[model samples]
Target: MELTQRIKQRLREVEDWNVVRDELETEAASHADKSEQSRALYDLARACESVFLDKAHAMTCYQQAFKCDQSNLTALRHAREIYQEMAHLEMVARLMGLELARNTDASIQPSLSYDFGMAMLNQRKIDEAKSHLEAAQSLEPSNERYSDRFQEVLYDRGKWQLGLENVMVQLRALTGSDDPLGSDVVKRGHPLSALFLRAARILQQESPDDPKLLPCLFKSLDADPSNDEAGYLAETILGNGGHLQHVQKLQDRRIANTDAPEAKLALMLAAANVWHVRLNKPEMADYFYHQALDLAFNEAIVDVGWGSDWFLAAYRRLAQGADESGNADSLVPLAERGMSMLGEVDCSILALSAGELAWKKFKDVDTARRFFSRAAKLAPDHPQVVAFRRAEGLDDEAKTTKLPAMAPEAEVLTRELPVADDDDAVDVRVDETPRRSTFVDPASAAEPEPTRTPEVDAEPEASPEPEPEPEPEPEPEPELDVEVE
Candidate 1:
């Protein structure tokens, strides 16, 4: 059943392929030995491929050859090549899995594992694909294909949906003139956009001064325009890098263009800072700040950092403006909003400012006291609180929000005590408090009313001048002598 090299070489002639294929098939069927039958069938499959150009028949022959003799995994490889040429990845994986299960060859396992991983990935078996891909990379660390594909899988495998979308993006990019993408993709969690974001961050970390950083960041946002973090990052970079004009254009294009709350909230904060901090256009800043804050307060968006630094900064500016203008009607709501997000501000100062605004702007003394109390509670020992409390009394339930721990004696008085008789009540209360002696200053004492020292009596009082006391004689001479001794 074995075909010699001479016959195989002759079989390469296309004109005689049908004759040779028929002869090989006859020989394979005649073999009683399975190994002999496998060899003859392999020759027949090759004739079918190279001679007849019949891939389907070639694949059938290859599979039959492998089944006849498991020792010839070459048959499976030939079948796999056909499946791969047809782009039938499921079949390729199935064939490869079978070959690896049966073959113990170490030299080819890495390539096999790699191919299998790719097939699994296309099949949407993410975690399994990762393992196989990782194994291939581990086995052959020098192979960049193995390692790079493995990393690509790592980038998105944490979420299967994202990984699947990422793969789809990759596939689509190859299938047409360009990638299938748009503004709405970010709202749907576009994975290509996420990958671009990671690349931009790496570029920023590795080469902060590189000119490519801005473009990379822009590309990420372009891939997913509604990405809040990417939008804010680009805004910050553009703003701080003296590209304020470009930043304005970027915000103008992104802000009102998308209905995404996160996009608007984050971008608005950035816009506010541009107007408020860089340009000193408070009127414009006020609009953007209110836009961001309204969304933030209404819980329409999550933390876009409003940026990492901008969220807190925006509120601070608003509060400062309110205090400086001396006319903000929403001062109470501002304080409440600021205090609610405690970590975003120097809360004691914010509360203190609100209290000042309430008192100075609107003469809202009670509201001022309420905020002052909160300020004191947040920072019990703030110098401003101390000075205010010392200079002016805020006496009421709202005077103090919190106090230091009571001293031991004071603590004892605060505890409830059993009632006692009226006589014992006085004693019990007095015993708990320290006794004190009262003193009166002569200057402060009321003088007795001048009675009828009438007109006639005033003249008679001149005789009383004899009441002046005589000077006492000195006994100092005797005392001095004893001291000297």
Candidate 2:
């Protein structure tokens, strides 16, 4: 019998769903030797729930069909949509996690698994969430999102748990030295070396009460503060009862010793992020924000012809941080300064930020609209600007504008910007580009070091020196004697 006809016949024979369900089950079982045919029968049975006049019966059949072929993408997608609308949230997480696990590429797994783990986490299935996230992380060991979440799961247990300590030890071992974040030392070259440092930071958080670990953690941060690990570690230490004196002393030392503007920028940013998030010290956060802006401004002015992405990035971070903390007054000046630095460049993002700051933080929609208008003009096609314009119920009269890329001729214009007399004597050559070198692997046994090689013995050749004049030797002693007198 056709699958649809069979389901219809069962529906006619029994008013009770149990009888209808049992009849459908028998039909499905008869086709069990043909898995594909059985799956089709199950699907047809599940589909009957809509017309069968029983909602609960439909759900059970749908679930059973899904169980027969867990890899059925079509069934999974439809089920998700229904469950999401019905608010049947329990199974959604497990299904999403399983689907992501089926992906073959390891690089992409972490992002997918992270989403799955988060859903499970929200459902309060902590153990399952940790397992899925760990599996994702194992596939992509360097991914920050997976590793960070996995550590967070470990942290949900008590602070003194040995499991957390063991993870820390494992991370520290990968670092490859006594250094808290071993191979993560800046010497590693890749930006992601910071991952190890972040792992170390998580360890510090797990052992917040241990005074012995606090200094070591800070010491490790001192070595590679630019990475996210240092920022995260610093935040945890500052927030969770570590000595503030230690943080300040270490920061001060870093600021004094490192002449690299990028390093200073990283330190300032880390300080700002840490104080704002962890300490709830808005005033301190503002201080670091101001410092970071000042440093970024100097870099832009010094290298105006180059990319200002770093400075722009810093500004965005500061603005976002301020917005989150409800510090509107602090955001305005910073945003304005950023706008000025940006000049005729597409200043739309800044405008949107200003509008947000005004409307949300200061409760001034009129001022916000004006800023939004400018942003709309600057970037009419931008999604954020368009959204804001719509929110204000503004008409769509705005037109997109094109801006010029930084031309090479702008170098002369940039050079015209004033430089301080006391600034470092290092020559600012427009032609000289910054060096970016990759890490060289250490020598293997097959590649012996020069010191390890036997030196060839050869006769030494020497040249005789001419006789030295002695007359000037007496005059030095005579001058010293006269000074004593």
Task: List CA RMSD, all candidates.
Answer: 41.3, 27.6
lDDT of 2 by residue, 1-485 (tens): 35544543433233243565567666665665545643764565444433232333444554555566655544544454344323234556645645665556555566667667756664546667787789878888897657766765765456445654564565566556554432434333322343444344444444444444444444444454444334344433443333443344445445544567766766665565444433444445455555665655434332322223334334444455554433335555545444444543324555666666677667776656555555544455455555655665554433332211212322432343222232331123223342221111112234534322122112111111222322112111100001110
Instruction: Spell out the clash pairs found in candidate 1.
Output: none
Report the C-alpha lDDT of model 1 over 1-485, residue by residue, as the tens digit. Answer: 13433343432232233566667687787999989898878887875654343556777788778878877889888888766544456677877787778778999999989988877764557567889999999999998557655765665434544544554466356334354332233233446566555545444433456554565455556555666555655655554444444555566556655675666676776566555433444644654665565555444233564322233334545555653322255546744653443431234445665665676567776565555555554455555455445545533323444432223322332231122232221111121222121211112335412221111120111012222323223212111011110
Question: Which consecutive 10 residues in model 1 have the weakest lDDT in total?
Answer: 476-485
lDDT of 2: 0.47
TM-score of 2: 0.34
Number of the predicted model whose lDDT against the real structure is largest: 1
- Specify the highest-TM-score model's number: 2
